[model samples]
Target: MKRILVIAIPLLLLTGCMHLNDPRPKHYKAPVTTVANKVCVIVQPEADEQIVTIRINEIGNDNNTLEKYGLAVIASAERCVTDFGYAFTAGKAYNFMVILESPEKKKRGVQPSARIYGASFSLWRLNGKLQATPLY
Candidate 1:
């Protein structure tokens, strides 16, 4: 029993250290190197519109190229917030989309508070972080 215990413990410990040198996402077809890092998008708030609940998500585009770069979605959150931001890998440039939704009470005559806004940004990371300018 003692001999078996000693051998099994070291074998398990060695398994954890085997992949310490290689750092790459597990699902990629090839190794990815270029990435934008931390990217942020500034969401504009409308004074006329009252916001009670706000949810922002990095939606899949026509190509659905979020993970194709490096941006991964955290559950339904998508790593995007009311601030609206995300970063992706380089190599092949692809479109990224965010759906920011603010639901309000339904008005009898007016349309629901739901609205979809779209914009393209040309921004890069500086010192591992980038803040997006307001889309106005």
Candidate 2:
């Protein structure tokens, strides 16, 4: 009886350890570009119900290429605000895609162009369905 118990304990411990190292979930793909002429900026107010603001300096145009672009800062109470901004729609699903454009190659000035390196998207439950989209 003692021998059997010892072997079973070790086997159970090994099985538990194996389950702890489960594989991670697959990576999510971000949008490359978005349609021009339409730029969406979503804002989620803080707990205090403070007013959120976004400032877009200039949406650049490169060689007639249509790219989703914007420049702005986010302010929120929960400190969960993103660089571009947050998407907040009461009872409606929202998606945000932010593409950081690289600075112009040939331009010498005091301030360099703001280059967007990557983009991100968020999904959440709003109203009665799941709506997810990229914001740029």
Candidate 3:
């Protein structure tokens, strides 16, 4: 009986010393790139300021994830005109078709603002090179 207790206690204590490493994946893979469907921009001329509304429709498999890309395109458009002396005719609205790059993976849109839209376009792409006839 004494021998059994001594051996059992040692075995039980050794079991707690064993270590097990985590087996989960650690690498991060970015979403794949896909072609955007439709792109449009609306420039509203106000008395004091011009409001630019860039509409990027049909972005990726997920409808929500496009806003980030949309804002990026808007910023690029603003910067493009600023850097290259591009501006819409004053007191007039303008429409344009743009091609944007987007990721294939679907992700949930997390913007707090309900009005915010996500569209993605690079400075070069938004440089009036890819403009098409207005769908409207």
- C-alpha local distance difference test of each model: 0.35, 0.34, 0.29
User: Which is better, 1 or 2, measured by TM-score?
Assistant: 1
Report the lDDT of model 3 for residue 130. Answer: 38
Best by TM-score: 1
Give the per-residue lDDT of model 2 (tens digit) for 21-129. 3433222233322122123333333222222222222113123222233433433323422424322332232333333222231133312222222233334454554
What are the runs in model 1 whose C-alpha is more than 4 Å off? 1-36, 45-87, 91-94, 107-109, 122-136
Better candidate by TM-score, 1 or 3:
1
Clashes of 2: 10
Off by over 4 Å in 3: 1-42, 50-55, 59-65, 68-131
Each model's TM-score, in the order given? 0.31, 0.21, 0.20
- Candidate numbers, best TM-score first, in rank order: 1, 2, 3
Off-target runs (Cα >4 Å) in candidate 2 are: 1-91, 104-136
> Can you write out model 1's per-residue Cα lDDT over 2-58, one digit (the tens) per residue?
999999999999998987744331221111122345443323433233223322323
lDDT per residue (tens digit) for residues 1-136 in model 3: 9999999999999888665432221221111111232223322221222213333222232332212123322333322211122232212222222223222111233221122222233222344343333212
State the TM-score for model 1: 0.31
